[model samples]
Target: MDAYTQPRGKPHVHLVVGGGGLKVTDQAGAEKFGDLPWKTDLDWIRERSEVTVSRLAELFGVTRKAFYGWVEGANPRKGGSQVRIAALRAVLATLPSDLHRTAFFGLVDVNFTGDASFREVFQGPVDDASYQDRLNAKLAEINPEIESTVKRLHRASPSSRAFESEYPSA
Candidate 1:
């Protein structure tokens, strides 16, 4: 979908780079730098996640040149494969803001036995159940009350008809 278009039904991730620096927003226009467990500002993730370009390149599974291009504001959706882009987005979503820079860098760099990289871990077959489970676990850890409230709000959200009637599709 185009930048201005919103996905049908539930909220969708939206990434944009502007004067405010790179910002990730949901369909509700809520600014979500990152999600649970690994929340951090997009600028920090882009500039400080890795000590060097090569390391960042390895994490994203892209060439140093390409990584530089992305750093210079290349759109992953337009310049990279969809699966890779999706994996990158998912990995970024979990970066905790409170995580130590060194620790966060190390976490993404050290490829575990089966996992190749943070991107690789989420690059498997399209299965959101496992992702959701991880998110839920992190949410519980961070703030169970907020998690419960969000669930309640989601459950109480307007139906598709009601939503459509309120905000007609463009």
Candidate 2:
């Protein structure tokens, strides 16, 4: 007989993920939940029902391949365990102007969401024309100083084309 001959039937293993609360058919099945148990052959989990493959896989470092294989399945899955998305926009709005990284993340969040606050502050409420007019009046109070600064910047700087070319993004 060939030294590398295969065993009779494949090992009797069943993989269950996420605390072994349920039964899984393959390593791939367990992988969706990021759990990979390779302890028993298909027989034990299905036939004997004594020692759960979930508990026995601990003896072997099998979670990697087994779980990842399931992850690669056509309908691979994932389980939630502390995977959090930051509420960056809300947090960033409150940050000081000097903290630019927060500003970047905040901007990203704002871009990610159709945030009403930003739209309200920037575009003004479409339904509230009077409020917009009031806002424009307040903005006008800050205009003279802004105009003077713009004029000063123009006077001190290079040509508009050159400036545009220098900082095309702005």
Query: TM per model?
Result: 0.36, 0.21
lDDT of 1 by residue, 1-170 (tens): 78678556665867766423566767655443223221222244565444676765675566876655455444443333334444444444564443333344545433444525444443344344565444334333434333444456567867678878889989
lDDT of 2 at 150: 49
Query: Which stretch of 10 consecutive residues in model 2 shows the poorest summed lDDT?
Result: 80-89
The lDDT for every candidate, in the order shown, is 0.48, 0.34
Cα lDDT tens digits for candidate 2, 1-170: 57578566654556544332345565445444333222222222223222333422221223544433432331213321111001112222333332232222223213222333322333333344454444344334434444455456557867658877878884
Candidate 1 runs further than 4 Å off: 1-42, 48-50, 77-99, 109-119, 125-170
Which residue pairs does candidate 2 place in steric collision? 11-41, 11-42, 12-41, 12-42, 12-43, 13-40, 13-41, 13-42, 28-70
Model 2 compared with the native: what TM-score?
0.21
| Model 1: number of backbone collisions | 6
TM-score of 1: 0.36
RMSD of each: 18.6, 20.3
